[model samples]
Target chain A: MKLEFSGGVLTAFIDGEIDHHTAPSIRETIDKTILQDKPDVLRLDYSGVTFMDSSGIGLIMGRYKLISSCSGKIEVINIPRNMAKVVKLSGIERLGRITIKED
Target chain B: MKAINTMKLEIESRSVNESFARVAVASFISQLDPTIEELGDIRTAVSEAVTNSIVHGYKEGKGKIYITVSIFENAKVTIKIRDKGCGIENIEEAMQPLFTTMGGERSGLGFAVMESFMDKVKVNSVVGKGTSVTLEKKINGRFVTKW
Candidate 1:
């Protein structure tokens, strides 16, 4: 995961497979950034991710809780097609704006 | 049903081996030439089952996770993931959506994903013994076939 913050938006570029093993590090990074910058929006970019399960959803949900308490919003963008179904299944659309990755 | 091919895998319950476990099963079943969507679904389901063993069963401790993949003659596949860790006390409560013992980062959706992605999910556990989750799915087999 890589972070870029500007204009109160902290965007996390998450790549690779998200499982129980990798999620903790990714979560830590994002949480640290959120705590430090307290951005007005947390954008989770899933464009670079190749594989994800419910762990991905957990990551997003945790962020939602963190940012909500911080009085910020979130945007989950560039979701790859292969993972769109799972994302939709998690009913994440209710939490933030989702922009699907174009083929 | 007779198994056309079969493979067994055993790895310690570590986060690093999660990808390896899922990908190996997908590759083993690739002989049936499953579609991309099918492959993705199986990968996600397998990941969930394996993760349950690592995060819940083994509880961030050291234990071995056993996995077996079998491809049947009718283009059906079954993957069994087992662990010799602390078992679930309440299978019914555990399978509920958003039900997780480890809160916060845990989504509590592992079993839900397994159920959604696979055609059948059978879970059998003994509190002090171990837990076994068997996932079954029929391959559309659009890409190739030797049978």
Candidate 2:
């Protein structure tokens, strides 16, 4: 995961598969960034993500709760079509905005 | 034409093997020339099933996870993930979305994701004995039959 903070938004470029094995590191990295930076918006860019399972849902939910506590927002962008389906099926869109970044 | 092929893999129930399991199954199914979407679905479902075996099934110590993949001439694939860990006590309750026993850390959508991605999902478990999750998906019509 690559992170950049600009204009009160922390953009996280998550690459590779997001599963139980990788979620913890991703979570810790993102959580630490969120806690320290306290950005108004956390934009998660998923274009580089090849695969994601339910663990990705948990990661997103956990971030949503953390950001919400600080009055911040979460935006999921550039989600791959297949990953989008899993996100939608998990009903994660209700917790945050999911925008497909056009290629 | 009818053809049947079966392959079984046994791996240690560790979190790291989750990715290995998915990639192995995905590679095995590639013979059907599945689309990216189809491959992603199968990979996601396999990851979920294997993760469940490692995290919830064998919570305390190391165990063995068995993955069986069967491919049919009609391009239908069946995957069975089994573990000799602590089987679920309540199958019905466990299938519920967002009902994880691991508190808020787990989303409890493992079964949900499997059901969504696969054509059929069946869970058979006997507490203290083990749990087996069977997933089946038919390749899209656009797929080519290589074998």
Candidate 3:
């Protein structure tokens, strides 16, 4: 339901659904982690993630901005097919910054 | 008469984060061992529901939104997203695909997408009170419940 961070890599093992109703928690968790751990890299594992919309794009973009500002890299792995469709449609892949991998 | 297995959250409308919420909930339900296609369906349904709330439910401005996700032991998960904002005047018209009231930019496919992906979809709305959407789906097979 929230963020579970560990290792040198801070992973947000997000639970429940991610939407306008649930994104702020993720944003806050990521922001807080960035400030605290200052991890060199951030990984958003979408393997467990279920749904996403255009608003989800903004969430990833915001994190990209946050991590980039801190001189850190952001990678997205284990994305599902349906969710991937939306992400690709957003042209985020064109940015070539979000690293998507299968689970 | 069974206790609802649900997780609830209240979120702000200003910050962009609904996608994260949708994905998170989908990930949780996927643990029930849904097939690849079933997983996709769940994800799409969640996305459509969340998008509707963000784009239509809270269109006026920033406000509080409620999202609840429930996974039954039978591999049927229900997601209820609610918002207290200007409600739709006609549910039937709004449910129509490509019937977006927001100019033509709105795909008007929110409910359609949800129906296409989920087993059951229900919307309850009032002209001014608010709107509540409930989406339900049953995974292909059964699984031993693990907590």
| TM-score of chain A for the candidates in order shown | 0.97, 0.94, 0.82
- The per-residue C-alpha lDDT of model 3 at residue A5 equals 57
TM-score (C-alpha) between model 2 and the true structure: 0.94
lDDT of 3 by residue, A1-103 (tens): 3455566676766554555556667778778888888876777776666555444555676777777788877777666665665565455564335655554
By TM-score, who's the top model here?
1
* Off by more than 4 A, model 3: A1-103, B141-147
The candidate with the higher lDDT, 1 or 3, is 1
Kindly list the interface RMSD, in angstroms, of each predicted candidate in the order they appear: 0.8, 0.9, 6.4
Error of 3 at A3 (Å): 35
Candidate 1 residue lDDT tens string, B1-147 = 678789999999898899999999999988888889999999999999999998889998999999999988778899999999999999999999889898888888899889999999999999978899999999987755667
Sort by TM-score, top down from the best: 1, 2, 3
Clashing pairs in 1: none
- Per DockQ, the best of the predicted structures is 1
How many residue pairs clash in all the candidates, one count each?
0, 0, 18
Q: What is the DockQ for all candidates, taken in turn?
A: 0.84, 0.81, 0.12
Give the better candidate number (1 or 2) by DockQ: 1
Winner on TM-score (1 vs 3):
1
B77-108 per-residue lDDT for model 3 (tens digits):
88888888787889999988646676423345
- Structural similarity of chain A in candidate 1, as TM-score: 0.97
